[model samples]
Target: MAVAPTPPGRRERNKQAKLDRITAAASELFAEHGVDDVTTQQIADAADIGTGTLFLYARTKGELLLLVQNAHYASALERGRTAAAGTTGALDGLLALLSPVVECNRVQVDNGRTYLREMVFGDPTEPHHAEALSIVAQTERAIADLLSERTRLGGEEAAAMAGVVSAVMFLNLAPSATADASVPEILATMRAQLAAILPG
Candidate 1:
């Protein structure tokens, strides 16, 4: 049976309102002026919150970005899920699942290096960082499920493949100083790597 969601209390509602305002303000500022140029003070001012309160919500600028990106990443994951549902091929489905996330990350192109580093090694105690880690684990599980159901792979092998694919996805997300690589190139490389383990 389905359970209903709990109603937010006065305090929880107020906190959500504040978070919504902050996320909207940060998104607008980051859009108008790139993430690197926008300051936390400006974001606070735009959100009509005090600088100290901003710190309570997000300790650093990168964390602020993570806060702003929370909804966008969730939306991307939904889109990936929809795309994956329409595919039968294993590699193709996994790529479809990750494509939306990659595109979303591209929007923060200039902040890739810092964002990627913080996302992996940032303070786990922070709410937004914890959400990011949860999302990563969720994505990996989704991939493993696809492999197990659609391909001729055992449970353990499917999970191992998910880990390898996760590694490739992270490496691709990492900032590169060289010329840009398109999405096709990135997926082609991922497919080749996965082919080694997937049975024919």
Candidate 2:
């Protein structure tokens, strides 16, 4: 027989509850009004927590955005991974891996772009930012795996090409130049770029 794990103490449970409230409040408000228009005070009020308490969880609005958007990005990546797994051709696999991500990013275009900006420029020491970086690494690893399977590339070659693919995806997803582009349009551009660079 095996022993069960200990349950969280009251303090730990309380902390998790507060974190959940904060995440939900931020998610709803950001989805409704976009991050730019939503204030921390509003989030705090919505969560029924004080502004000071909110800062205890996320130091800045950008970090809060990361905390919220990271979950969405993670879910989208899971969907993409599943889609890619069923895909056959190299380009198709890559597009399948990226399609949901592009759709997620375009849901509220500014919020998505801002999330990318924060992930790039925010404090790496922060937990939320670190988690965001980890997600990006996971994405690259997934792409590299797909490349190894579908192409002549493997090891470092696959990894490097995966990084390039990631860059192409990010550029199309976040750039001011593509801000007005639809999800399908952004994906079309990515498909073209991948077709040119990836081995047939």
Please, what is the whole-model Cα lDDT of each candidate in the order they appear?
0.81, 0.95
Candidate 1 lowest-lDDT run of ten:
175-184
RMSD (CA, Å), each prediction:
2.8, 0.7
TM-score for each predicted model, relative to the true structure: 0.87, 0.98
Clashing pairs in 1: none
Model 1: how large is the Cα RMSD against the reference? 2.8
lDDT, candidate 1, 1-200, per-residue tens: 99999998999998889888999999988867878899999999999999998888899988998877767778888899899999878878888998887777767565544566778889999998998888878888888998898898889999888888888877876757411766666667766776666666
State, as a TM-score between 0 and 1, how close model 2 is to the true structure. Answer: 0.98
Model 2: colliding residue pairs: none
**Model 2, span 1-200: residue lDDT tens:** 99999999999999999999999999999999999999999999999999999999999999999999998899999999999989898999999998998999999999999999999899999999999999999999999999999999968999999999999999888789999999889999999999999986
Best by lDDT: 2
